[model samples]
Target chain A: MVKHKIVLLFPATVVEQPFLYHLVKDYNLIINVLKANINPRKEGTLVLELAGDKENYDSGIHFLESRGVKTVPLEQQIVWNEERCTQCGACTVICPTSALEMIRPEMTVTFNGEKCIACGHCLKACPARAVEEHY
Target chain B: MKVNRTYDEINERIKKGEAVVMTAEEIIPFVEEKGLEQAAREVDVVTTGTFGPMCSSGAFLNLGHPMPRMRMSEIYLNGVNAYGGIAAVDAYLGATEIPKTDPANTNFPGEFNYGGGHVIEDLIAGKEVYLEAYSYGTDCYPRKKLGTYIKLEDMNEAFMFNSRNAYQNYNVAVNLSEKTLYTYMGILKPNLGNANYSTSGQLSPLFNDPLLRTTGIGTRIFLGGTEGYVSWYGTQHNPSVNRSETGAPRTPSGTLSVIGDMKQMDAAWIRGVSFLGYGVSLMVGIGIPIPILNEEILRSAAVKDEELFAPVVDYSQGYPYGRGGPLGEVSYAQLKSGTIVIHDKEVPTAPLSSYPKAKEIAEILKSWIKEGQFLLTEPVEQLPSADSGKKLSPMKIRSRGEEN
Candidate 1:
């Protein structure tokens, strides 16, 4: 089984649809919602951790897109600019998760996208401003 | 029986590819195993390095005279203002200088995306930088203003004359307040959630030559990327500080003014960095090679991170308001260990200085000397020591009646 962190955006028209229920019941996917927000326009946005087999995960993603829901990998929203990074490790201690860590001996910072909860601590912690979020 | 080495002696061995050279970090272990005397006799030179955000860094640029000579009274590089009071076409672009349009701290924490330091990095990287200058038409210089793009190579002269570079030691910043604090030392989490320090510890040049015995004015060094020289004692050079047995300062003390040609520098060594809410600064890579003149010099050069200490100051209160002294003191070894206990609380530690980059710089300088491409120089004058009578004083605010 593969575990993935993703975000789903539902347009106003389909905001009330039970897409997550269908994925768990029909596609055999496990849904762990990290955050759920509904805007004044009635659009629903969810940050979730989804776990399922390969075929089931693909089918689950397809189901979301089949409706008016847009799926995006959670890691894709956060960008760590390697070229601009000085590898000073100021963000290493600030990251709540082990997403940002110092690779010892070499002392360079390595980023693990899967582990990042995108709490945005590193964004302010980095002296080099190497970490950024699109949304 | 005395063991000693000279600049000429070490340089000869380096020229012959026979010099026994090691980095500051390497000398520490070698001294422990072989003893200071033996290491002194064997090691010809101990190279030291540091890479940190130096806000006192800047470049003096002489963007060649415009089409019809203009005595520039004001100038901007990449939208960031530079000091243009030097001469007709010369200006000093400081690292912390931001554009006039920058909202700064009005929004609490400014992004500080681009500034003077970025322009310097862009120029060094062979990138085109927008240049704008304004002046009143003069007799010898007719042009009023000029707008153009200039590269480092195209400039008449470009050099870095930093007023202060490598600090001998520095404070380990932490916040004791309930709110998070943003500072030049990086962000300090509330209630000392985390601590931030910015020295390379054992590998640092100033720490290696704690007393400033061999590393001083006129001494050759690696600045940015190419060879540079220590020009003078940096501003705020406080030598009247507590010292270790090896003569290393216990707190923030000595600093060096450095100069170098910007044309020969590597873009990788000279970078532009931002400190969240603080501002922009240049991350400079500097290395100083200390010739093993005697066992005493060797003994100081071999000082380790465990022996060097930095004061843990509360940035929110003690620092800005000068309310009181540091909360406590911690060794560089402890600072580098990822965590330190303060007031029985295990506070995670982070370093703004990169140890790997410092090691890389030391290795590069070692290679340059080993290949005979570089040679050691005896400093014409030494820096002030623990008894130099140099005192860093606070400025007195003046009133209208005060003398100009």
Candidate 2:
């Protein structure tokens, strides 16, 4: 099984469709939405994490593209500039995952890339603007 | 075992290259492993630090009298206004004072690119700043108006005098309402989506000197890369807050009002910052060295993040004081874990204070003590304890014809 984060853009016509339901039932995939902004009869954007077998994941993407829905894989990761970072724990508090933490005694920030979900919480919370999103 | 040492004795040892020094970060583990008795005897001075936004801070500059001296009534420094209420040629540049064009609360605060704090930073960097002053023109001081440039060195006595700073501990801020909130704690996502905690935790000045035992009036400190003194107890200093057995406040408690010479400070240590949608503030770098007078002092300095806890407040409500009640008391360890369980819901966490910068200040102070350039001054008076029953009540209006 593979886990993939992707953004789905739905046009006004497909806003009423059960595209997500079809992906789960047909491809046997597990879907967890990170963010969604959708309005009826308007353009909608969705950020979701999908977990399924490689073949099924491929089929789901193909299926989404065929329905006039734009499916874009999420490849953005947070980049922390050490030179600019004051090691304030601002990013650690908002991070959904335990990716940013203050090491004891020394009292410095340590970033674990593997645990980061790229939620972009740190990007907004960082006062120094040291954390950036890079594809 | 009890430890005994004096400031003079410590200095004497330092003069003979026999004194032991360590940063608060370095001494904690050593004290834990070696025992307080041994560690207290081995360590002469332990430097503690905190780097956080201190809004109640500003610099007073005595600009040398221009060609013709004038009692300036209005003054602007680098586009940001300064209070010229003092004597002629003297001005106080508040940290939060912004430019007139960028009136605070008139529009988005993020649009304000610079303020008085930036002017101070520029001055410390050896950069010249535009100065504009106006007066009614007195006989002795004839100049009505003047526009020129000035540097920090040109000012006769430029000193940073913060009214309130070094908060003992602070609250962990979060938003519980549907709408997002912009605050000094940074932007809080709607519905407790994320929690931002500020403070250096154990590395903070007051935490290390809990109860203000060794951090009261006349205590020498490292303020913005220079030597400074604790002038008095900070404003709104409510020592009557809840505290742990080790004397560490569970909430915000004792604070320090400090004064330091700006001429001895460096630009790298002091910074001006704005919280985007929030207002402006000054990022002050302060380090206070705690002397190991006894085992109690050693034990207090050994307090860690796990032992410290702060209330996670809901900022969606009107002022932090009226944020209802806290979700619960959360340790710094749990706060730094990125996910705190509040009301059975997981909330993300962040911090506004810079631990990295705090650590750097601690290290810098350590080096200064090791080099025998910095000597810790024993506080002349200990701060009043919480049991003092000092109440700060709001002023009430007097009724018409009320008896005295």
Candidate 3:
């Protein structure tokens, strides 16, 4: 059996005792509060660190879903449109995840698929609508 | 009294059963009702101003002390986010560039230089300009000329958004801080100097300035060119009552009203010497209009009785004094400089009584107005005459007759 440590972050509004009561009762996983200061507009994400069998790790995904928690497996790919892209560096600046970085000297941009969190921050920030998330 | 009196003599028509043909005095209610309905359709225009440096050039200046002899050309070349508008910037480039491969071992240079300049022009001219700046091992110089031009455009956009965004963001942030300071100073005193959390989990600040402490809230709007900045300091409250019997008031009504109040309280509560600044500055050609209020006191004093009705000549000199008060000239100068500092420290402390320049401008404008060169127009329209209701009916009748 795989031992996974899953951490969930809560927005200030959801910190009430009633919400915690239902959450603690439903999940067998341990919960850890994130201490970093967060902007009110930002949505909180859960971080799960798993160590052990792959099968048990996969089962944990279903457990999270049963409690109405949405889960998306992260992927690494550069989705670009040949027609709409204008090669502006706006996506590079607004990407909180740092998935996109503009290469200096040439002033062109490059994407690091591995570092991408698929947050869609780049998409919203992009004026050209050139970037898309590939599965 | 005199034979059979006309219906006009009976204090205008006042028919009881035939739906009274009300005279002007009697139709006051109907007229007022229509006026009220018309007033409802009128749009309320609220405007504020901001002043700040935005974009890479501005950002560089704001980061620290001002730089001397900074040429516009240098800023255009090196500044990031240089372009004025995003739409203009987007028309010039491609998503990626084709990497140049080496024959030996098939190891490509880490830098993806497609070789050429004016790539943006090429892209716009229906040519595909695929140029990437990154490489695996070595640094890529994917067309140095293309990057130089593109950088200029980016810098312009950066300046546009930075200036405008900063203005708005700073206003809200400062306002938030002011509200928190007041709550802690007033209702929860003894702990006046101590910091505390608001009902909402935000911190408050205890202000050191006595003037700021006494004033529940203070707001200053500064307009410099097209850029504007607003700074507000004080307790968080909706409709920020100027005067109240009690210092504390009940929670205000409306969605986000409480949130606004909370932001103010929290901002004040945090007490970490909060300061926020935001405003938009045009990059290239856009010019913002400046509004000057025409005060009756200033106008009346400036214009001589003899010149009031004359065909005013040379109104330019008189314009300044006619609009602004004693500080009119100085304020105008400040507006042109494109910078307004609202905080106590930021505003000049020099006594206006002793300031010669300010006095000089005021005197000049005052003289011009007195010479009958300047005229002041009414800021608001007068109420319609009592006979207006009668005129409206006739006009409607005429229109209907024409249609038939």
lDDT of each: 0.89, 0.82, 0.24
Deviation in Å, model 3, residue B274 alpha carbon: 32
Q: Which ten residues in a row have the lowest lDDT in candidate 2 chain B?
A: B104-113
Error of 3 at B32 (Å): 84
Please state the Cα-based DockQ of model 2 relative to the true two-chain complex.
0.30
Model 2 sits at a Cα RMSD from the real structure of 6.2
DockQ values per model: 0.63, 0.30, 0.01
Deviation of model 3 at A69, angstroms: 5.2
Worst 10 contiguous positions by lDDT, candidate 3 chain B: B200-209
Model 2 lDDT, full chain set: 0.82
Considering only chain B, report the TM-score of each candidate against the true chain B.
0.98, 0.95, 0.18
Better model by DockQ: candidate 1 vs candidate 3: 1
- Could you tell me which residue pairs clash in candidate 2? A88-B354, A89-B351, A90-B351, A93-B349, A93-B350, A94-B349, A94-B350
TM-score, every prediction: 0.94, 0.80, 0.20
lDDT string, candidate 3, B1-404, tens digits:
11232222221211222112221111224434544233212211111111111121121111111122111211121111222222212221111212133121133211212211122223223333232221122123122222222322222221111111111111100111222222101111121111111110000001000011111111111111112121121122122212112221112100000001111111101111100111111111111111111121111112111111101111122222243211111121231121223332122111101112112222332232233332222212222212223121112335544872
Best by TM-score: 1
Superposition error at A63 for model 1 (Å): 1.4
